[model samples]
Structures are given as C-alpha cells and as structure tokens.
Target: MKKDITIPVITDVYVAVVNEYNDIYKTQDWNAYIINDKDVDLDMVIIVTDGYSEKKMTSVFRKKLDVLPKKSYAKIELMQEDLFALNNRFKVSFFEGNTMYDKTYVFRKNTINLKALQNIPLMEAKGVLVK
Candidate 1:
C-alpha cells in the first residue's frame, strides 16, 4: 500500500481535555477537542487511541467533515472519561484531495500548557486557529 503524505498547511491540530458545564443537563462534562486549522478542508476525520483494541484502550471518535474551511476549525468532544493522561496515543485520520492522511499524537498530560487552556475559549469563539 502507498503511504499518504502529511500536509502541514492543511490543518493545525490541537488536543485537549476540557471541563464543561451543561446547563441543560446540569452536570459537569469532560471533553476532548480535536481542533483543526482553517487553511484546508478535511474529510472523514477520525480520532482514535493508538494501540486500540477491544480488550484495552478501545476508544474511537469519528466525524465526517465535508470541509474544515480556512480561518475556521472544528472541535470534537471526546466521550472518554480520561482525556488527559500520559502514554495516551491519539491517531487522527482524514482525507485531503482524495488522499487519506493520518497522524498519531501522544499525550503526556503536560500536552497543553496553562497558557493554551486560557485560549481555548478564544479559539472556539473567535475561530482562532493555533498549533
């Protein structure tokens, strides 16, 4: 099989575990974000834990993004309880221009610095894309 190329300009990826409060549900929600940059449109975006299996660490989050438009990004909330942890591997797969591309990101709990967390709302609200 041929290997797909990684396009750096296509999308800037960000992974984070956030604490969100649901007004409707009246409960605290922990979510993970798979933010993509706005430069390129991404399709079939799938985020999964590396070394995933039925027995251990089998968490997969999939989304079909027809287009992640430029100057804009997408946020995917992970359902998994434990989002921030060491040795957590996240594999992101998507399609760009008919070519399927994928990359694996390892989390070390310190993945998102304190400064980055403060900017999450700005990023989400203002379409601020960061890497």
Candidate 2:
C-alpha cells in the first residue's frame, strides 16, 4: 500500500498581494492584505522580510498591524522595487484565539510568467494566498 500526504488548507486567515502602477512615480507599488475569516480576531499581526537562508540579501521592508477583526482585513504597502527577484520572501505572524499562526510565502516569478501583463495598463493580483 502507498501512503498519501495532503497539505493542510488554511481556513482561519488568508494573505494576498496587491500590485499597482504609480503614474506619478512611473514605478510599481505593492500592497499586502491579511484577511481573517474565522470568528476570532487576530492580533499582533506583523509582516517581515525573510531573506533566503543561503543568500546574502537583507530585507528592506517591515510593517506591523495591531489587530485584524473577524471577517475583515488588514492592509500594508510593501517596498516598491525588486519584489519579483529570488530570495524575496514574506513572512506573516499573528495570534488568533490565543493561538499563534505563522506562514511564509516566496515569490515565484516564473510561475506567473505572463509577458502580456507587462503591456497592460493595470494588472491586478487579488485574493492570492500563500503558494
């Protein structure tokens, strides 16, 4: 017999990256969000850069949120450059129902290889959770 393994589905909290183009600066902007779907409120929410363990890059961005109410979201704007490069990782931590939760997400630029997005006026990547 063969054993099967399954990854747990995250149900209580979710995170997303929102990207936008700045017309005034002619640069890109990134915003992230944390949504709490459970009845409990999340507290001490923090987002930090997790440089690749074997790499020599330093995280240039950090943000903190006091609380995320149930069925609501908390938002933060990320640093504007080199977001798609390798070793750019995001880690989020929070407490829900007195339990701590933490997760990390790495940018997989190649997986989102859509050259056409470069030509579009506005590219939206909404409701995208950790992958």
RMSD of 1: 5.3
lDDT of 1 by residue, 37-92 (tens): 54666677776654232344544545556665544445565334443333456677
- State, as a TM-score between 0 and 1, how close model 2 is to the true structure: 0.61
Give lDDT for model 1: 0.54
Per candidate, the number of residue pairs that clash is 1, 0
Model 1 earns a TM-score of 0.58
Weakest ten-residue segment in model 1 by summed lDDT:
121-130
Error of 2 at 128 (Å): 4.2
> What's the lDDT for residue 69 in model 1?
56
lDDT at residue 87 of model 1 (Cα atoms): 48
For residues 8-52, write the lDDT of model 2, one tens digit per residue: 344666555555566888976665566676787778988786444
**Which candidate's lDDT is highest?**
2
